[model samples]
Target chain A: MSGGLAVVGASRRVRAAHYATERPRRPVAALLARRGELAQYDGPRFGEAVFVTLQAIDLTCIRGERMIFSGLTFSVAPGRALLVRGPNGVGKTSLLRLLAGLNAPAVGQVRWAGGSLAGRVSYVGHLDAIKAALTLRENLAFWLAYRGHNRSLAAALDALGIAHLIDMPTRYLSAGQRRRAALAKLLLVDAPVWLLDEPVSSLDGRGIEVFMVALRRHLAEGGVAVLSTHQELAIDEAETLTLGRNP
Target chain B: MMRSLWALLHHDLRISLRQGNASTSVVVFFVLAVTLFPLGVGPEPQVLARIASGVVWAAALLAAMISLDRLFQADFEDGVLEQLCLAPTPLPAAVLAKALAHWLLTGLPLTLIAPVLAMALQMEGAGVVPLILGLALGTPVLSLVGAIGAGLTIGIRRGSVLLSLLVLPLFLPILIFGVGAVEAAINGLSARPHLLILGAMLLAAIVLAPLATAAALRANTE
Candidate 1:
């Protein structure tokens, strides 16, 4: 049984090598023959317009004695989303936090629209900022007021499909519902740049779909979103910026 | 900026009022502390009366300190502190607004209730008015100073004890003058100097403590 398993693994490795080498070299006619095989492969497209930019920046973060990430440089422009993919403990959230201006980068500068992304950005971290004591409507109202948005809270809640939960205290809401409320807060704000740290972490499949739809709307409206996610998001024309792997 | 400050203050006040337990607990603790003093030290009416002003002021300060940890713990846990820091309003203004709201909920009620507690402890009627007034002017300073401690210890695991240890020493002058003012009033002397000094301390803390607390918050976050 062990010998048979080893033989199968070796044959599979050989097949993978052959497929990797020959796939890119096939002509359009040959590719047409493998359309069914390629149908399942979905990834983001590159070379869209530039929305936001981070120059050759050195972000030296020290949580006691560890340097999280250093000399990280990347930029995402309009019509392009930077999907920060990295293993846990690779400072993915720390990078987003730095970009959001919540923590100052030890030695780097992150600029949006040719300037610091201070006032023109919205950040939603891993923790839900909702107050358990306040109803969803009250939480949204407080955030909107804090962001100086004079829009209709009812309309915002309606857009997120959270109008049903508007009067319920956020603590009683499910994880997906809490996430939706937080995303609603991001949408209600009028900022151009969105820094979302694992916005879909606790979301269900339906919740993920709702987020993708909202994100697509934001991208369509010329707003930019940067998020980190472990789950594959099959958004059309989205770009992935893998951190830690390159360095 | 002022609008943001006002909004934060209003929001915090509304939340505290709706919750109702934190402020009530602080007042209840204040009363318990005052009552314990008469019980523990013997209920000689003359002795209680002689020490009533100091007893009430010390109990009020201790009660205020007991609830200082709650001032920022809930907001910090709920991520509201991060939101406040990120708001377009200046950090100092936001911190000042939160501290002011805390004073309104905790300190203001203590001031209102201290007179009754003082009377029960056999305090002179004339001293009771000055006791309330002194607390009115002095407890805000305590709140502001205590906010600095709270901000400094925002994320520390064992922070409440450290916060009291850090703030109580700083609060001695306010307590001294606050109780001193009432004692003078009880003695039929003008308490104007002590009251004015306590007011000055309040004004100074109101101006300075927010800046210190904002800096402390920034340092802690960093």
Candidate 2:
């Protein structure tokens, strides 16, 4: 938790530039993935999210009898984002799931700092996972409690600009509001590697704006993001991985 | 870890209670199914007493089965199971919390209400204590074992039908010992052996079911 809090009222450029200058980057990112997967792997392992890198080395995804994707290679360094792009049924979601460790790669490895993906990734797939019966506050607070985060619940809500909807039940929320709430969880969760499958799928203009703000904030803090989105993201420096185009 | 598990347990109970009330449906099915026994067997007190233990045990097993398919289905569909598996607490411990919550929500209440149902069936007073005690010990095994079935069938379509086929056969030992305990007590014989076996089954389930269910979940999730 070293100076990990987002700088309040600081410009994004100053925040990103100042944070980099304030703390010298260490090669610890090379082993941040393995540190959490120690000899005893089950406990909550909160690694420093800065300077970490996610690597997928020659990964192959086999669903049933078909090889969905193969010989795929990529690495997302800290403070950067990987945009996974492909046509329908082109394995964007499959690749993300493999990286998230939801499905095992038939070959190669999806590693963080060259170690197992355990406890290092926070993944959000299409379903949102929000309880219909619970209020937005209850839903986010549950994830906070699950991660054992001591931060105030309102902090992340305010970041996503959904603080007013905190007490409202999620069942009453529209599809985009639920998606925003799902993105808000990315802030509450302290993981370095975030795997989001089609994150901006149903977000409106305002929801997309706040999401971009939060995503950049996450990147500025030296966290890594691997997201697959149908809409083109406005991130200038982010790398793109086009699946199925590989011969 | 325990705190997170407790949070999950409380979260599950709260959601279940506020929504469609899974446990209530299970209990209602349990009560109605038990009530059918006396009606089918006529109003003869001796006959009802003779069959009450078996009748109640059978109905409890079916009621518990009714709740089993839902144990993981909603969470799996909504993708909550993925987050749950990735949570800081080990998956097996998380499975244990869910299984305990299931028992507490569905099994424990079923146990408490069994005595009243037993009285309606004219179960002998001497057998009543053993009946309640057996249910208290036995119903957890139902929830735990049923969790394994639920986990294995998570993504399968119409899983409830397949869940019953997989779980009912395994439920026989618990049903046998549970009914045997009460029937033995009614027969003026020692129910200790039957009760002890049921307790041992419970201990075994507590240790094994979580690991099995976690593995099933992993296989299904992949």
Top TM-score model: 2
TM-score of chain B of each: 0.96, 0.98
For B1-222, candidate 1 gives per-residue lDDT tens digits of 666677677778777776778788998899888989878999999999998998889998999999898877887787777767766667888888898898988899999999888889898898977888899999999999999999999889989999989999998998899888998888899888999999989889989999999988877765
lDDT of 2 by residue, B1-222 (tens): 878888889889888888868878989999999988777878899898888889989999999889888889989988899998887679999889899889998899899999999999988999888988899999999999999999999999998999999999999999999999998988899999999999999999999999999999999998
DockQ of each: 0.27, 0.74
TM-score of structure candidate 2? 0.89
DockQ-based class of model 2: medium
Worst 10 residues of 2 chain A by lDDT: A1-10
Q: Give stretches of model 1 more than 4 Å off.
A: A1-56, A245-247
**Candidate 1 chain B, poorest ten consecutive residues by summed lDDT:** B1-10
Which pairs of residues collide in candidate 2? none
Candidate 2 residue runs with Cα over 4 Å from true position: A1-51, A245-247
